[model samples]
Target: MTAATGKKVLERRLPDERATARLGEDIAMALRTGDAIALVGDLGAGKTTLARGVIRAMADDVSLEVPSPTFTLVQSYETRVPLHHFDLYRLGSPSELDELGLDEMLASGAALIEWPERAGDRLPEDVVAVELTHDGEGRLARIAGSGQAYERIARSLAMRDFLTGAGRGEATRRYFTGDASARSYETVTMAGEETRVLMNSPRLVLGPPVRDGKPYAEIAHTAQSVTAFVAIGRALAGAGVSVPEIFADDLDRGFLLISHLGSEGFLDAEGRPVAERCAAAAQLLAAIHARQWPSRLEAAPGFFHDVPPFDRDAMLIEAELLVDWYVPYATARPAGEALRAGFRAAWNAAIDRLDRAEKSLVLRDFHSPNIIWRADRKGHDRLGVVDFQDALIGPSAYDVASLAMDARVSVPPEIEKTAVDAYVAARREHGGFDESSFAEAYAIMAAQRNSKILGIFVRLNERDGKPAYLKHLPRIRNYLERALAHPALAELRDFYRRNGLIGGTA
Candidate 1:
């Protein structure tokens, strides 16, 4: 089913609910080994209809009565890989999914689940998420997933769509088809050499905000910019930072596709302790910041407004949002006006202090999530650095703050300090800055940066409604407590203790 290189399209309208079911069946029939299809949409939104179509198309012997399973929980069918069709609508909690042994089934056969979002984190990381929307009598289906299995299914769907000319010559192009129904949108590929492609979505929420219905810049947010980032990645290669190479970037659609840097981020890996990891992280930061930039961002205005230190307002805005949106939500009455006031003072003081320090290039979001622990011949044991689309010319200590006081992962105090020292030593060895004051500035900035993170995490849960970030609040607060414990922050620490921050928001 693999094509060396060719474009294919397919299209068919689901005139009715039954037609949607038929479409699903066709998609299922095209599935190869290791396929998982997750159906998502509102109630009676044709998810079941599509699932039925897929089931019918895949196995001729299977029955057509694919009910919603609102009560039975999950109805298993015998097909290739023994397809398990789940209706989580009635399943009260995600843990109940484990009770049904869905994990084992996911490995052996295909799984079709309706209301998959209810399963949340339990769903397979690579499971296909198919969103079905009822448009008048027809249905619009959007499919997204990753892995070799989904890749095959995507290829098959695209082939079917191409054979049938489903959405050809339209304003948008069909990227793939399942059974008779095709899902298409504006897609741009970055590089043919690498499988990972940079893509852009002018309409995707993550896309930069639109003004007047047109994108911001003429070259604005295209595959080309992704390529530039990749070029930067290559430049940083062998220089201690282990960033993924950019294979392609499709700017028209705003996709900065690049190599997948493996799944063993600090969160997934059971490698070193927090301190050891932070130490390694600090070493990388040292190498990155110590290097000279060819041009200052202010000197080259239009090229990159995203790079750090140059765009102070945007960076400050991110921190301010954390304070404005996160603090009130994370803290209880214990964090009264005094405690809150102290926190603000610390942030402002640190920001002011660091704002005046000698500046260097900073990878703004240099935390655990951005790192990948991959194997290589380099003396270091793991790959590090990613999610650096917002790299900037700012305080060298900014990225260190991001690493030692990570929001997603905790670094031991001893380890954090050791990492700080290591960065200081490395910076001095590279020979450009004053060591004495840099140490003081590093501690102050670390505390301030982490305070901002605490606010950001709280805000992520309270404002964005993504509560998962709340789990890391304790670690962030830990960093804050330690940073405040410094003699320089004695007054801030006293204010916090009086207010209730010592033990965190209770």
Candidate 2:
């Protein structure tokens, strides 16, 4: 297969219905809102079967019924992302598609349109054309597109090549959830082999400088590439911390095939944090903080990443997110210059105390969502950690606060105390652990983190169109109040109260 008009094209041979389904699943992983997958093929060419596979992959339910829309014209399903399955076989002309509400469907979600050729030039400009033909025993698919759709098709092909090069060419791909960041994940399974995970973290395209001539990601020390994850994962694993083992990597493309840590999370079925699991996670953090970690890490031969320290500038900028996005959200107006100045001053004063605290490799998101429990492993090794690509050299208290006052799940006051005590006791065994000062640092770090999150969640809702994070605001507010209760943060608490950001007197 070849591109006819300089557009990107990918061709694959599907030896059977299973292979066709697998290809559909891979393509589904690359689908996003506004993407239109135009399925064009001859009758009895397994187009509906391929469409079924794509729908099931996006829905993550293999049993989902996906009947052809020959009579219904269009069938819509609510999945992780909404999907419209369109069969234009019965359509008489292109203009008739306007009656199907195609524009509204594309605006809200994605579409898989079979017999799209019937729509003629009415199709969206970004449609990815998947043309299938009957092979000797199965089928051949040629995918081509332009613009963002073309880029997504190219990425899917790259992932296919990566897996093939890693000796899992025939593996089936399944979509895993993506986070608020630029990365996404998938699980790949091959016959009679242990399942593996594919971390599809493309190199970040830096935005225009937001502060100090640096992008917001660079200023905040966010991971710029998969190298950070690879480097940090190896470093942690070398120290006997449980992390997914890297099996294969395409460093240039930012793809990695890694060991699949099972789905047993630190929380239970009811979404409550288990006390024992929380304690173990705290102990794991203690073990990490007790070690001496190097500032520079080797990601690959002759390539190194220097871990940036969590400095005053980074902390202040993070806290400013509250001023940047949250203040307007809460107050219905942008923060005045005075309010911004006061906010910065309070955070600077609070961050000054971090200099006296114990510093170590801080797994920045050491919360429930990133933690997996291994029942077969011993001690801290039972805790499987992921999403540490953004780790930094910071006060140990930050991670403890992240775990104890977890943002995703509610850690009850008693459970939070138990976890905190476990960490403190474990640290004491290593000696020279200052309980009084550590408590103060924990409070400050907790307040700073929750403050940043308050703005981040709102930004995600308003700017990024992701409303799920907003649901955690009440929990984050409670955590902030708990952190503010510490006498060390009284002045900062007063500032929030004065600004009417929080209720009650300081």
Candidate 3:
């Protein structure tokens, strides 16, 4: 980072084409919507080669054909994050850029503009400038940028440094997927080594205080750093659960080189949940909940990580998301204090019944997206779980609800029953498992979790500039209805119904 201009500048000698390709991977990981990359270099300076690398990485295809837009002037590709490759070498004039729809393209995605100097003042003020030049039979590259792109690129370069320190410096990097959280993923491949995953989850920042002078993450017991993943992951592995093996880690920087837990997920080809896989995942959860878990884990030698308790305050604050965000969005009016008070009172009463409930390490978001299915492996090993950084010591039934009422995909009633049965059967076989107590706890947890999701989706749409999550609101509502049917959630159901959030308006 430059002290005067705050521009992030990195100078490196690209010894070969592979070095330039690796640099492209680093830039691809740093990309965000509305970002622009100004490839500054003379002809034959490896401009198109670098752009091809970026496109291929984003496409998650190593051999993807990326032609230079020299003649056509601009070409685009459909990717997780859409990208446009522009070559202005044959441009008629600078105004042709507007005709080419650069502004409109950047609204939804990013652009890679080659020969960016031709555009003069038309280029975005916020841009990442990559200067490539001939350097003694090789190439010299200088990357300079600022803003969110700068921070992200700095982190991305640091991740490569982490990999280099771990002895995987020459590994190929490709964008995998990103979650609703701050984490993003990349697949790292090195010849003769098993494919590994690079999780770039930076230390979470506690945002402005929302209640009781605390942020929502605090009240929700969300993980603050990478230490939680290391702690919970090691603990789960020790208990015979099939979590990803941590090969290398930088807990302070929040970068982990973990074993690539296969690509197959709980969903079948048609994008629906497979019953057998759902049952298998439930059994895996049973194996997890059967054993006792420690409240504090030694994440590193002499560094203890105390698993936060998902207590009453946490539960209430989570449910309040519905009243605070979803209720107003659903009804098109802010919830009155009277309605809010009633909802809070009802939830407080509902949580009181959990005094006799079971407790375990709850993998809060144990749904389809997080479950990796390995058909070749047997028993519990057949399933691999990730995204457990926010694991909490909470009601064991919480995870059961998460699976059966999966928010990412629709789980039919039969599949839901299959999962619940698998869990109950495995727990029962282990002895001292109380079925009746679990039923109520499951229903209450399902309701609470769904309520929290409803608000979160709305917050994502309204506050976070991510409107895609709005599509899942209806599915979440239907799942919330299923949870509301339980006797344990009677009063909470009444509050919803009175607000026309569920069945029977009157």
- By lDDT, the best candidate is 3
Name the candidate, 1 or 2, with the larger TM-score value: 2
Deviation from native of the Cα of residue 483 in model 2, angstroms: 0.8
The local distance difference test score of each candidate is: 0.59, 0.89, 0.90
Per-residue lDDT over 332-440 for candidate 2, one digit per residue giving the tens place of the 0 to 100 score: 8899999999998898889887778989999899998899989898898789998899999999999999999999988888998999999999999988889998999
Top candidate (TM-score): 3
lDDT of 3 at 304: 72
TM-score quality measure for candidate 3: 0.95
| Candidate 3 residue-wise lDDT, 1-506, digit = tens | 88997787988789889888888888888888999999999989999889988998888788998988999999999986789999999888899999999999999999999999889789888798999999998899998987787678778889999999999998888778889988999989989988899999898998999989999899889999999999998998888888889889898899999999898877999889998998998988888898888899988896678999989999999999998998888888998999889888999999999999999999999998998889999998998898898999999999999999999898989999999999999999898999999999999999999999999999999999888999998888889899989977878888888778777331
Put the candidates in TM-score order, highest first. 3, 2, 1
Lowest summed lDDT window (length 10), candidate 3: 497-506
Residue 108: error of model 1 in Å? 24
RMSD of 3: 1.9
- Candidate order, lDDT descending: 3, 2, 1
Q: Each candidate's TM vs. the true structure?
A: 0.57, 0.94, 0.95
